[model samples]
Target chain A: MSSPDDKRRTIRDVAKAAGVSISTASNALNGIGRTNAETREKVKRVADELGFRPNALARGLLTKRSHAIGMLTNDTYGRLTLPMAAGVSEILVDHGVSLFLCATNNDPRLAKLHLDALLDRQVDGIIFTATRIDLEPPPELLKLGIPVIYAFAQGPADSVSFHPDDAQGARIAVQHLHTLGRSRILHITGEQNYLAARIRADAYRELAGPSGQVMFGEWSEEWGHSAIDTVYSQSGPKPDAIFCGSDEIARGVIDALRDRGVSIPDDVAVVGFDNWEVVSKQTRPPLTTIDMELKELGHRAGLAILGLSRREKLEPGIVRLPCSLVARGSA
Target chain B: MSSPDDKRRTIRDVAKAAGVSISTASNALNGIGRTNAETREKVKRVADELGFRPNALARGLLTKRSHAIGMLTNDTYGRLTLPMAAGVSEILVDHGVSLFLCATNNDPRLAKLHLDALLDRQVDGIIFTATRIDLEPPPELLKLGIPVIYAFAQGPADSVSFHPDDAQGARIAVQHLHTLGRSRILHITGEQNYLAARIRADAYRELAGPSGQVMFGEWSEEWGHSAIDTVYSQSGPKPDAIFCGSDEIARGVIDALRDRGVSIPDDVAVVGFDNWEVVSKQTRPPLTTIDMELKELGHRAGLAILGLSRREKLEPGIVRLPCSLVARGSA
Candidate 1:
């Protein structure tokens, strides 16, 4: 249904229709340069009548600001990137900024290629994001001479980055169980190699004191189901509460507890992390979990990058945004 | 670590280093206008040495091609968009094209705003995508004087659109079960209002014949679990296999069957649609599911849009890409 290219109106047409020179029309439309108030209003009215939209590319060439940014991410699955991107786009769209999302999928060569493409487009700024906070972006990003920020991803020590406060997320999960009068809290989590798992376990240990039990395994429901067996098999006081590292693990714990005829929040309260709706809400008794607030992290990252693009002075360091707990049926 | 902007190399620097005029250097580097082979080589060498990347905006003014495309999507959770985006990006990145993803969250005003932003940027093409294929894109998109394509989304009757062959996906799922010696197959699916669910049910009826049973319910694990009780409670001859409309429902069915002490594959084989890894792979005994091949659809859509941008003659119509079955432990 689109019209022919020749049918599309241009600024030249607006200028001719307004009985003004091209420069005068441009100035009036842009509200730049000295122009008579009557002439400026006349040109604007004519442009509006013609439904003329200014070309951002042409404006960018003159202003040296593209009003566009690029997001370099390694999160191909979009588990983290999606929410973060939603948050970033939410903020940037209001500012009339467009975002280019380039997924590298952890391939170094691909990352470099995407980075170069973004540079060729002359994006005002770039945000590097990934699945985990431990993963680092390409080192070349620092030397691009443009504003750069990290969201839910690691960067150089001095670079501006945003991350979820995993320690606090864990503390709250354990504290919630304690508040419910559950003392013997057990931490069922993922691999020790994961920084999140370690951070959460450390926080759980702090809250649960000497009676704390930490079971490290894969981030899976099967592991959660099996860990419950390992705990109940031991000749000791059974845990009154279980805080899982992920929603999947919590689902598994709930299923395993039901299989063993244990009542949820009655015999053992269950809590999870990442607040993944699909798994958390699907659980028999919906999971009480910690939300990483990835979107908020992205929002902050977007603002910081915009600030840097505007040459605003900002202290460079990692900023850990707070995580919030979503109370559900299980805890 | 980035150097000052004044230190950034430009075409002028390359021209000065190569001892040629700016236009000559540009022509040589772009391989556009006729330039002596030796001068072209010299300009290229100097440009490479100086790390002078050409500004796409400046080149776009002459070429009228931005080498950038925009993707307008309504898939907020990214359940469908992520894989599709990966496919689109996979094809575009190789073509040196950057993709701008704008999330509208189904708000008409937001969609219009993002659409305007894409148009203002002079993007070479636009792709409209959404979670469901039955939903229509904004009517204004059809009026834009540019090549537009739809991926995993619906557009005008004659527009170029790519969608998963739901009937084919369902047939394959059912055929796979039949091939496994499963007879009296039961089809448990989501809401009947969904075109996907209806199409899949029709396909199931075709393969399953008169004995085919269809259970319409919500697309959730709870539904799958409860549907099983409903089926067994009144059933005379239990089904040998169950074909679910989604992975979540299949997971619920598998869990409920396990609770009922029904031996999988031995008593009841189950097949699920939407090879969603989180649910299919995590289900007890895993799950054999049909993949929508959304990424492949994206790849084809990218290629089609690129072809249209190049003014290549392409037949405008809906193209239903095929689906494939992923074999796992459940079936």
Candidate 2:
């Protein structure tokens, strides 16, 4: 193992070893300027032998490209940010770009501090992300000269952003139940104040027409269990299918139905949103849920940001990525 | 809003505005060399007035301190790594240092690629983390000239590493059960091959003496549910308390016990490991579990890395952080 005192090989050493001027050595290695082809090859070979890796800091200074990007997020638990970050890293790493993740934890002061640090570091671009799409990023983000992209968060009207199509996802769930030959469908969702819940409820209402029943409650398994009692206690007719806003809620619904001695998909079929593996896969019969595809949204945003970093002209608008249904045992 | 075409204020500009030599201005702002206190204050005032932020890349070229660190992890799911990374960021950000996260996805080749990128960027240090402590990081990690600290992962014998004390955590759970006057205790855990499972089982055996029973199975809710049947179907004294290896297992055990008309803390008490809020809180009566304090381990690792970066003397060895029991209605 090399000691901390071991000095890294520098371009100067490579130049001396290759018997060329410093400028010629640099141009040859970079494959630019008016360096002769033969000299370039010789210098490159010498550099390879000497194990000369160009310092990113030095190279960034000359080219004005840091080859680094900053990701500012308010998702403290990483429920949404981590997968998105993984997708971003998947693309950025191949392009020799490193990502810096700054968790603001919803503190505007902390967010501003992190932003300043990123700007001072001369990051090529910045991607703002959050747990939900309704929240807007700091206004100062738009004023920054460098490129900016919003992922899983709302941005200004003239900015580029990506989020899942919640309404479309709701439609897919309702359609799946419809195809399964179920007419009475009930929507059990999270708090009405949440934009996602409102959007999903609206879509379900549109499809269910006048017969659709919507219940707004907490996004918890407890809520799902109680919702069953509230719906079944009524004398009219027990819904043949139930669409839950989240996997947690669906798990509860499935458990409640089982406790009541009702057979799943026969007495009542259950559909869920957010294909969270832990919750969706562990349910008694597993849950058929909607996947927001946050990772894919992040991948597209990464590519767009990379293009913008290279000064490519990109249209400014909101791009709603499609969500997919993960069919399991329940529905 | 500043346009991309607008030029950034440089040190030279600040120096000219302050009516001082560039070298003097640089020295004064940096608080070094023979610059007088009066000149230092004047230069700083002038720089601030010009909205001048020092370019970190240029500063790093001279000081060899990039004010950045890289974190390499194989935790693709981010279940464990995310909380640890958050703790790391919490400490490092306060010290004006930025963190770069490189996910290797357990691929050796990918790990090498990320390592090389971090080195090229001149990151002051690196932190290696993973989902488990038994797994060793790439051997190349030790050979890097920069300081490296292992968090939630094993390091070489003479290197620094941090992990939760599993045996201690198990003992705490068993002791809590004993305090509740539950003499007949059973330990139901995941696969025995896992170091954590074995250590925890060993601790339980030590505490329960001759009559302690342990069942090794998959780390899933299914195992917990079936293990109950396996235990009850036999003509033997049923355990009064169950210590689970994970929250999922505990949830399943609780559910099965409830289905069999068992009253929690009245007929049987359940304690779980890994204070995973989702599973622990959602359980019928909530769960009392052991918290590994993974985030605190990350926080301490971050502090240690910073100390190493500043050339502070730190002892190298394995540090086992204590796990605390989270009390709830279950036990």
Candidate 3:
């Protein structure tokens, strides 16, 4: 007599009926597994009677695929890695692959120590999100032979990756301003050595007609402030709109502009990259920036790794995902 | 003949020079550990000539401590956990402890699986970052009796904890608005079921003086937009300032206000929590916020757990950290 909604069954309800941990229930139902046959059968029997349809991951595991993804970021970039990893996790979770995440502190000494830990546990594939793609990955990391994809920053290795299409995102910004009848765009950026910054600066110039100016600096509010001061002192029709490389740089520009009583959008339209929510939310005018779909990158990485794990012909090389223009009041 | 800095010392560097991992070198350095004494002596002689300072972790493991902290995070709030765990790991690394970090999808079943994995490896202590506090931990888990520290959120079992002082943070927001000559202020929030939200809402009312207004609802941008709409329509005086419960709500309120041509600061000053860099950097006017200092929180939890492992009286109960204000253009 009860509605279907009233009879909804959970892993817990099934676990209690089968006398096991929720993990056991999960393992039994989705068995690329590490659980006993008896436990799996008992849990499966309960799940069947409850009219439960197991998640895709459980189903994938039975075929020896585990349908799971492994994610790794070193502890050094702790602040940025979590959200990036979270975005990756959500994408994989939706695609029915469980994500096994691990973090290390960028201690080169512990490189193999921590990564091998994830490999030993047998994640179908791996995603390495690095803060600084500063060095070549250890040769041993290559030994695992699982599909390992790098995100956010690319590494010195020949693994697959789906990075933020910084070049495309920058070109979009430059083109947006040109379409709006604005000229003399300025490029503000982080350190010159950064891989993404280099691509973005190149794009800004190629797209900013003939007279666009570019400034290079570190990723800091102070750098942004310094860039604004540099722009203010220049002797020319001040660049109509500043195409900031990162939101941090944009804030510096916006703050300096406000301090000098310069009206935003009206006086100097600003477009920033990296739709980083934490930094973006606090701005005076909600900023219009580029949305780098990191989760999608994670999904692509997961799929690539899964494909590689099956000894399938993995499409070799890079995957650069498209970045979206998020128009807010700033541009 | 070399200066002390250039001088070659011995102990483990020779082992490191042999191209094996540091832990392997560590095993070689301590003749009493698992390695063959010949390997240990060879490593020791190489270390002596190479003048390698034995890594504290390598040295420390010899005298009854693994110098490792095992962290388990519920996948539900992994966004928060990732940064917190990273913060803790960095702190532990600084203290010469390697972090054994694992993500448990907040399922008790998986938690037990990971817990057993960590325990068998004999981590010094554990730090748990979770969302919910009501679920009972496994009896075997409870019986393990390792020192556990809960961060950002609580657990049902008795343990040590450290969380931001949300009450004080809310009070600071209200007090800041009071000084800004704003009388009618509104509170936009997340669901009441969250302990953090409830504490913040209660704090808002207590701090907002008698003439202020409080609006409680879900913690989404949509809720902020709708709540602001409701306040603007039937409200007693329009809220002069909006004290959003989270960064997400603040972003929505700002968007809603701007679409209606309402200016920030000149209209409604805004404040948010979590100081997520994403929102702060992307928004036009950077959000003025209270930095939850997640990394610092992790540091404390790591230290607390380590202290507990030594059978030291880790004062059982919550440790509330002070939140610092990050001033930006929004307010």
Candidate 4:
């Protein structure tokens, strides 16, 4: 192994060794050039073998970018967004960008304070984990014209976002039961106004084929109980399967149903969304849910934001990542 | 409505209102014996009426503190710790302290860099969120000798920490089951070396009486299922109830049981821990688990670390907060 004690190699050394200009060597190393593939590969290999790691600051200076992605989150309670932020960070780290994370917890003046904290740090791009954009983003964020993407959910207004395919996710739930030859499916989901609920509701109607059983409320266990209770009210051939909008709702649906002497699968199979192990794996009946792949969302958001300026046109819009099923006993 | 044009009122304005020197007014506000209680109350009431809030920055300068706390999270991938950090932030926010937050993404090298960043910005105190103390804290962080409390689990060495009362938490589970007139309860848990698992095991052994079943393994749904299977293999009157180490394991156990068409509560009641809505509320049977209230842990850690110094010859070594049983249908 090359020792740190050995003559430390710089990008200049690599450029000299490869008989190329410093900028050309940097462009090759960073994959930002129109050089021939052979030349790029040869220079890269030599740079790696010589341990010629370019000075990030110098590269940033030349590129006129920080290569630092900002993650805006709630303060003090930054924990809720930490995992999601970590996912974004992991993706950016591999791309050689540092994560500039900021939180606004103490004061909920909405995004005003937190947004300021992030922008002041001059991050190249931003990823927000909140379900909605809470405050009117200072026009400065848009005027600065940085590439921003909302992960998990969309921010307010016309900000382009990357969201899980919710309707498709619900379709998978319906299909899983359909494949098992189960009809009479009941949909238990979060509040009506949420975009997730709207999309999933549309999917249930599409798959359940008219007379679809749709129940809506908050993403809480109590909502699950209440929704199930309402479903049980009309006792004419109750649903044989249930599609829960989230794992939380599914858990409540199962529990409330079980309490009513309804057996899961035998009487009604169940499926959930969001593969949070603490909820699904710990529940009495392991739920088959959709994996939103949050980490992947962060990774893509990082890459997308970092590469925002690559195309000099405003092509920002929704980038829907696919959702997949994680089958367990309940479904 | 209050005018947006109004400048935020401050202590100097309050002192001016009471026609007192800044020192005399500060003594009154802080009750440092330079002013009588009656004078203090009068001055406070006047300050309130004028909406004069203490200028925390200016005051912190006087106090040689920031009236702000820094949080350095060693790892963010572990979703369980998020609540702990959130709780701390929530509590600190209520107490009116700005929290400077950063995550290490579980990289010690990055953690050091963050420490340097926080130090460069001059944070008053730090709450290091971790399951263990950092073996090698940044040299400057150590040099700053600012108070730091390792919240969530025990510190790596003999540093201060705040964790849920796992021993008492386990006892609560056993006692809850016992109250249900079910004595044949099995204890399923995680790695014995983890501080929480060890304390929980001790509590189970001591408070569970002789017939209670006890077992340990990694905290996962797979382990929960295997543990239950092992207990049933013994055959002699299968356990009427099971106390799971975590919500994940409980979900697995319940899934396996449901797959076998076993009944819950009627045939076997199951209880789990960590009432994480992210996971627990989404499970089938909506697991009956312990609410560790991690948000409160973060809050306490914020205060403990900032209010009392680790190097100062004061304060407690460890603080074990209470955990509560969030009763749900699985049990």
In Å, residue B5's CA in model 3 sits off its true spot by 38
Q: Which model is ahead, 2 or 4, in terms of lDDT?
A: 2
Q: Ten-residue segment with the worst summed lDDT in candidate 1 chain B?
A: B1-10
lDDT of 1 by residue, B1-331 (tens): 4445535578999999999999999899889999999999999999998889888887776678999999999877878888889889999999989899999989999899999999888899999998887886889898788889998888897789898999999999888888888888999999998888898899889989999989999999999999998887884999999999999999899989999999887899999999998898888888999999988988998999899999897887889999999999999
Task: Give Cα distance to truth, residue B67, candidate 4, Å.
Answer: 8.3
Q: What is the lDDT of candidate 3?
A: 0.69
Q: After superposition, how far is residue A186 of candidate 4 from its true place, in Å?
A: 6.6
Docking class of 2: medium
Per-residue C-alpha lDDT of model 2 across residues A85-195, encoded as one tens digit per residue: 988987899899999999998888889889999998899999999887788788779888899999988899889998899999999999999999999999999999888
Report the number of the highest-DockQ candidate: 2
Assess candidate 2 and give its TM-score to the true structure. 0.97
Give the TM-score of each candidate.
0.97, 0.97, 0.59, 0.62
Regarding TM-score, does 1 or 4 come out ahead?
1
Compared with the true structure, the alpha-carbon lDDT of candidate 4 equals: 0.69
Give the Cα error of residue A274 in candidate 3, in Å: 0.3
Clashing pairs in 1: none
- Please provide, for model 3 over A2-110, each residue's C-alpha lDDT reduced to its tens digit, 9 standing for 90 to 100: 3444433568888998999888887888795699887888889988887564332233324445454556776443445665655565455444455545566666655
Task: Compute the TM-score of each model's chain A versus the native chain A and list the values.
Answer: 0.96, 0.95, 0.78, 0.77
Candidate DockQ scores, in order: 0.73, 0.77, 0.09, 0.12
Chain B of candidate 2 achieves a TM-score of: 0.95
Candidate 1 local Cα displacement, residue A138, angstroms? 1.2
Q: Which stretches in model 1 have alpha-carbon errors above 4 Å?
A: A1-7, A33-36, B1-7
Q: Tell me how many residue pairs clash in candidate 2.
A: 0
